[model samples]
Target: MSAPENREAFVRPPALELRGVTKRFGAGASAGRGARALDGVDLVLGEREFLVVLGPTGAGKTTLLRTIAGLETPDAGSVALHGRDARALAPADRDVALVFQNFSLYPSATVRENLAFPLAAPARRLSRAEIDERVAWAAKLLHVERLLDRPAKKLSGGEMQRVAIGRAIVRRPKLFLMDEPLTNLDAKLREELRVELRELARELETPVVWVTHDQAEALTMADRVALLVDGRIVQTGTPEDVYARPNSPLAARELGTPPMNLFDVERKDERWITADGVELARADAGAPERATIGVRPEHVLLDGGPSDAVVHVVEDWGPSRVLFAHVGAHALHVLAPRDCALRAGDRFRPTFDVRRVVVWPRA
Candidate 1:
């Protein structure tokens, strides 16, 4: 599809809304004292927008998704779809399709049968021919048409995942919710399917809310990302916004491959000393009065001559090398170009991209 046509096709109305949504488990008298899975979570998904929710484990990511799918009702707050109250709606009545992490397919059923199951719902009332057509279309979209006759139990993890996605797509629901749908597959297959799913979601022009802990997947597939922490969304923005300008230390740390290097900075008159003893310019430092500083590995540069310290370890990672150097009480990782002539115990000076450093208030 042409870029303009593709963008236009994906235009959609607000398909999902969560306002002051809070989900609590057990009574106030319980041992945990009413564990709140969600705490006043507020979110909105525009038509055809792909929103990926990311968080660490125990962050209530799953609970938030379950609530939206109508499998779990929020103890407080409301869910709306197309301006209608959705909290009172049943899972089927919500016209939402969920592709779960566990690949919740009937083990004994063939791929074709599993894909047809959603269409067979009494409320759908689809004709047999229509169901077949939908199943065929979804299978083609997911590139699983060849596995149609195989029983779900016999399919590989990747194939089963495709089947699960196909089943959800056959319903053509107003909203699509995926809970780490590619987590079960191998890394290579997961990467492959990530692109496929993005294309499929774009083609269908449906709003999607996907939950995943994989930062790379979030960066690659999501038009916008919601960073959830402790059952609350800490930040929400486009992948570029969140990655380049994270509002919190936690959000910045969560977006990188090796994660952002966090250090305590001590202000010494006009300059700041990172925990690793690298002197930082005051003009380039944010929160200069604070003690914490964060910089991504890629922003660090390795040079010879007058430097902070020497490289203690070098890990070659094909395109680049991660140089772990000792400056003081901490190790600062520097992402060096592959040809960088640095070895363990090599004397190296470190330079930082001043514009890329992030400073956080000391706690």
Candidate 2:
């Protein structure tokens, strides 16, 4: 390669990179006796990227953030920050900001002081004017400028969260780490902040590694998502890609709302049959005799079909209906239009969108 090309290639690196990172708790981390919080996880985040680590509770989402922030040390593998090994950097030296679900702030101080606290760190050399300017900028960006003079104790939950996030942004760190920061807010506030935070991250052009168990946040805000399960990195892809083309049943279960309905079935000739000998759908000629298949709620069409289904319950969503039903022996969820006149004890023939069905080897 030419010298200029070499130089260009050398200059650009991922904002954050993790390779075979492993962390454990309890006894000595290296003894292999402790519970592993992170295990052989690999991920890469591009410059100014928004990556959400989506997982269930106890999936080591919090541990992943702490390891990135230098608050926790991994027992194995490497963490690279902007191409440099992070083994030697202290938490403060890594130039990263962390925001948590619980609003961590100085309750007695005004919002201005809370936002400015990070800049006042002993390690930072910012002058008073610089700190104040950044505080104003962060507060304005978070739409909490009006609450600057209010005591932290006086702010509502949403305001306090904005301030917590403002405190992180005021320092202008290279990366932002958020651990379910909106989980504590009411539904309306959480919805509002999700959009706001996404815009803020783009406006700042700062890379973020936000972790959450909420699939909604991952789907709505992420440029890409990393599925973490049992301390392992299961899958990484754009929200749409991961949602539509999950690599495994475990991966399929992580993203969907009302979750994907999975079934274990046996392939019989050209058909897939459920446990009780009821035909479910068509099976690929080359497919395994027994495997697991997944169908999302919306894919279960109820207009008219071959199989009989009895609606056990109906939930009226604002614009649609969710029917909990039994199709033969399979308990299923079907999404129907709000106008559909279906109630409990109603019966319909349910057909599935076979093209969208996902199949995996039975485990």
Number of the predicted model whose lDDT against the real structure is largest: 2
Flag regions of model 2 displaced more than 4 Å.
1-11, 27-30
Q: For candidate 1, which ten residues in a row score worst on lDDT?
A: 280-289
Q: Whole-model lDDT for model 1 versus the true structure? A: 0.84
**Which window of ten consecutive residues has the lowest lDDT sum in model 2?**
300-309
| Residue 58 miss distance in model 2 (angstroms) | 1.4
Question: What does candidate 2's lDDT look like per residue over 69-178, in tens digits?
Answer: 99999899899999999988999899999997665689999999899889999889889999989998998899998999999999889989989999999998999999
1-363 per-residue lDDT for model 1 (tens digits): 599888865663367889988887878823535888899999999889999999888889889989998999887889999778997788879988998887579999999999999899888789999999999998988888999998899998888888888888888898999999988789999999999899999999989999999999899999999999888898999999898888888887777876777777777665667655567544343345656767788987775323466788899899998888876556777888999998887876666676787776675
TM-score of each: 0.89, 0.94
